[model samples]
Target: MVLKIGDARSMYRKFKPHLLMVLIQLGYTFLNFITEASFNEGLNPYVYITYRHAVSGFVMLPFAYFLERRIRPKLTWPLFVELFILSLLGVGFTLNAYFASLRYTSPTVVASMVNVISSLTFIIAIPLGMEKLDLKNPRGMAKVIGTLASLAGVTLMTLYKGKSFRSIWSAPIHMGSSSIHENWLKGSILGVASCITWSMWYVMQAYTLERYPAQLSLTTWMSLIGGAQSAVFTVCVEHKPAAWIIGFNIKLWSILYGGIVCSGLIIFIQLWCTKEKGPVFVTMFNPLSTIMVAILAYFVLGEGLYMGSILGGIIIIIGLYLVLWGKENDEEEVPMRSS
Candidate 1:
């Protein structure tokens, strides 16, 4: 049977959900850039972190009860366990680790490390038997190469040394007297650690979705549990009497936006998309965030969008497309096996 151009176009329209999912990731990255800038202005990092999760949890609770309480599948003990662990891992530990790292590191360092999600998810998913490894396939090769290219782009964005590139590879790199090893090294370690923990959160979230599959409701519950956990941790470790004080009007609004829109809403969207599509499908869009963040940082925060960042962002986007195209042609079904 011959297909008309109109028929082909109509068929392509079915992928709207998938396309929307990719856009949502871009949305997240853009919002996150603003959130970071807002975070930098005032308010203690840990307290803001605490408040964001707390607001997310409290805001999501009533909605979860009303919108999803009845329709959600009955929760088994095992599934409940999974949800609890997911809450602790994805929300509690991940955010806590991230905020802690942020205290120690620059956002650029954190952003660079975030690219590790693609490689980490691919590597861990194989061992967990949640994804089949077909190293021989062109699609698989593309996934690997594309991820590396994306990382290279991120490296360029974060670590490009201009014509002084060789200097970065050499020892005793001076930043106006204080060496890079002396000042910037701690931040780099924290950034890498945050990335590993963040990857763990993604893997666990994927597994949790398999069993108790109500994405929004599950996320809401996790936010509640995890928020409480993080709040307690923050209170113990970082919060002071003054830390609870709302310092500025902008900071107040920033926390609200970060909590309600960025953390709560976006996470719900992420779970929905990642569950509907494969993890790789959701993850392939990670690099596109750099483009959005770079632009936003330039205009809103008055941070210079360096030439390396712009070029690297474009390369990263290209690599992500390559990864997505590779994923589309694969027929393998890697069921979310019990982790």
Candidate 2:
């Protein structure tokens, strides 16, 4: 009887992290849908990002001072340097690249390319020593197969290239701005570059978590620093007084929602999930975000979902499950403790 009980305990232990991971993915899905709705409405993506970070930074400050400061890990020079780099990679460069891409490509293209992160994470994980690849194992085979399947899905979605304004997919299609077509190819390249940069950010976060281990605290500090940096950059690049001004009540509320709910809270959840279940696990679940965004965009942006997006999303979902199953198989079973 004791042995049976012990075995049951061990099984539960094995599944615990995976359970937490699913919950985190669900939370992110919710946030992604809301944020997508928010962004589709006239808000400039960079301006949106800047405000989100600023609010997140503000929200994090008191919490860090009161809760984390006393027990905060000592900051060595190397860690400080890494902290700065992380802010740059995860927040600054990634957001800039993402917005730049959005300026040129359709959201569908942007969403499809995000699938690249799973493959990118698997590749980048090797050099960082964050994850090991067992080239000979069934698990390894699954991961590779899954990654390729996802890439194929992206190709199908992008290459099919439905007409801009007259699609059967959604509502009255606005093929974005008229200027987009003039530079659509360049925008597509930039969008993919954004995906690569964002993938690197995920890997960096995983690497940093190993050293910092304090999820909320680290995100808070990074947000503070990143906010300042981005704000300054926006001032130089946009140089539009109207964009910077926080005048109307609606604008104030929007900034607060973006910053606190989307940025600060969402980031805390992301770190917790990644740390618990591993980075690839979290990345694999990101397709849920795309699905959520699709639904929200339909209602909010009146952007209809085409058969292509549906088929592509379904393919991406299949690929995600493949990768996750591969990861699960890769995990070794360990003995568990008594209650």
What's model 2's overall lDDT?
Answer: 0.68
- lDDT for each of the candidates? 0.68, 0.68
Residue-level lDDT tens digits of model 1 in 75-124: 77877777777777766777766655554554555666778777788777
The lowest-lDDT stretch of 10 consecutive residues in candidate 2 is 330-339
Off by over 4 Å in 2: 1-44, 161-183, 249-253, 299-302, 333-339
Give the TM-score of each candidate: 0.82, 0.79
TM-score between model 1 and native: 0.82
lDDT of 1: 0.68
Best by TM-score: 1
Count of steric clashes across candidates, in order: 0, 1
